[model samples]
Target: MAVYEKVKRAIEQMVGDKSSEFKVCVEDTRGTLGGILIKIEDVKTQEISAFRINEGDEGEAEHMTMYSVDTMLQRRKAEGIARLEEIERVLGIKFEKWQREYILSRGLGYPIGGRRTGRTLAHQVKTLMKSKDDIIIYPNQRWTYLDEPERMRNSERYAQGYVKKLRELSEKLRNHGINVPRVIEVDDPQAEFLTKRMNLPARRGDGMR
Candidate 1:
């Protein structure tokens, strides 16, 4: 059997009836080198998960090296197990049972936000509102506070304005029953605002004003 076929069989056995609509296909990576991509969809909820198996080419004869059928099968099995664990962790339940109960009960609904992508102003405010105990605020914008000497020389006013904004925001949240203990000011490396504000003329060599 071909390498792709072997991989497909392994994934099928691992998922069982849970992946009735699964798909396994080969993707071209470059000239004479390619990999297999597998996509598994939850039968009840139709939620999809994907995994890949790259063509192994690491050795003295890198181009000549290829993954054996057994190696590909092992990789597919491991990836399938990982996908199940990820689903369980995100949804807070066993994958098999969750599929049978919650997914079937609610037609099609999947849990989101298992990882922290980035901090936004709205997200920070919401977190503060939900906190029961006093929470310290770390303003997401780094360039707002002049904690260092370089920052003080660059744009102290801009930093002050950022702190002022945080204070105002904290006050508003306090009115809504959110306890903000303190707001820690931190300096940002990429001072875009400071650069734009201080568009000073090039200084010539001398003690001239």
Candidate 2:
């Protein structure tokens, strides 16, 4: 019989379709017992079963795992564009493309792409901002400035104001048991970089006391 057929039957017989969802794979080996290997999946628990397809050996082996699609999707959805924007709003950081992707990738969600989605997400973040971190005193990329130097100067001023406000806010948040970043250093001369790392939880609704 075919390798897939053998594995399919094994999965139906052992785990059953009602109890599990799985995919099958056939692999060829080079050094160790080189032959067609039939593999079966238990998607509900992210478990795997492997069996060799040789005339002499037909033994099955179970691999340890906790593989569940629900779990994986939950993790990924948390990293959605909406979530990153929420973090940006909460920490009062200007949203950067790399940072959004980083957060989305962390939770296994789709990355933000293009202006339509980006703008929609940005708007959504404004709604989600709970405190001062939601406000950007100086916007990045020069929304309106005469020259690069003028923009940089204005940005520097904005950074200084943002950091000073952030420090004051951080003190208040700390008092209420909200975790804030250490703010090791900023170089706006005026403090303009204003890049701070906030302690957002891995999942939503986690901020509620």
Candidate 3:
């Protein structure tokens, strides 16, 4: 509760004068592991966004998130080309590049690798799927998500963001010739999402229904 208060106040400060119009909730996403999930909502418009601060992360990457995919693509393309050229010069092999844009909600997109790159990814995934004899579950990739979804999903609007990401990601995977959707739903009786108790009675007693 103390930690929640501290983080709530910090967010309130960041939100400024309109902070009163917004509601913020903080929960330990993974109990005893210290991963924090923050959800914010507008009272009038009911606009919402979610962010997570991982156990060891200082929230630096959230700030470092690139809004301009063009800039990021340019930088990454240059680095990739340099690496490719070096490999080609030394190994006597040629390479190809493919560029395509898949809209992420609107106005934001990630410039991913070429058709060959995607095909390679599909091959690797197929290899993994068939590896029942040598499968290692929970490989410890340490990939904790941040607020990138809120930024990229539904053009900065959030309610349908998760769904949009799921559907689009499925489409992208199919385009990569992968037969699996990168989304899943677990029906947990203990689970709730984007829900809150409005008032005391609404939370408990007569209004519980």
Candidate 4:
């Protein structure tokens, strides 16, 4: 069977009867400027058509679609980095690579901030380290090697440094073009005005600044 046909059939099966009202078209050879040329819509005469075309035996349609999707995701990630840069520029701060990776890998959603579950950043990080044997905090970012209760206070210093670094990093990220909350006064502010004044949204749709 033709490659386009195979892909089209596979897509149809995956979509199942959910596409009853829509038509899918498949072209034997389809090429789009940016990606695959696949359309899902309604067909006349109470029928649905699902059409897909192949640019060649290579299943260019599917390949193009995948490529487009990957490209979009890459663009988003770049935008995120850019935003981080803007944050730094605006906040006069810098972020280590390890810290950036940690935030991104967490998938903790945009507008990243320190962990806020009543547990301190140090505690959470320590817990993560204990649970995941493979985790290694990078050299640029300090980590606590807490094995004894007696060392708690000393280990906590590491946590304090991390918190300070993260705040600086977050600011740097905002300056990098990532839309982040407008940094107000960096010095101590009134406690009552702290949350209310800076509660504005930081992240944009594309993670852009």
Inter-residue clash pairs, candidate 2? 45-67, 46-67, 76-107, 76-108, 92-133, 188-191, 188-192
Which residue runs does candidate 3 get wrong by more than 4 Å?
31-34, 56-209
Best by lDDT: 2
- Candidate achieving higher TM-score, 1 or 2: 2
Task: Choose the strongest candidate by TM-score.
Answer: 4
Model 2 misplaced regions, further than 4 Å: 1-70, 73-154, 186-209
Tell me the deviation in Å of residue 16 in model 2: 32
> Which digits, one per residue and each the tens of the lDDT, describe model 4 over residues 30-122?
334432345544331232333344344445555543443334445546755665565446546565565554433323322343345222332
lDDT for model 2 comes to: 0.42
- The lDDT values for all models are 0.39, 0.42, 0.37, 0.39
lDDT of 3: 0.37
In terms of lDDT, model 4 sits at 0.39
Better of 1 and 4 by TM-score: 4
Instruction: Single out the weakest 10-residue window by summed lDDT for candidate 3.
Output: 200-209
Q: lDDT by residue for model 2 over 1-209, one digit each (tens)?
A: 45455455555564454334667777776367876666656453365656564542434322211222234445445545554544556556766665454433322233554444443333323222322233333334221211122434557565455345444554544565544332222234333432333443222210111
Q: After superposition, how far is residue 10 of candidate 2 from its true place, in Å?
A: 24
User: Pairing residues by index, what is the TM-score of model 4?
Assistant: 0.33
Q: Is candidate 1 or candidate 3 better by lDDT?
A: 1
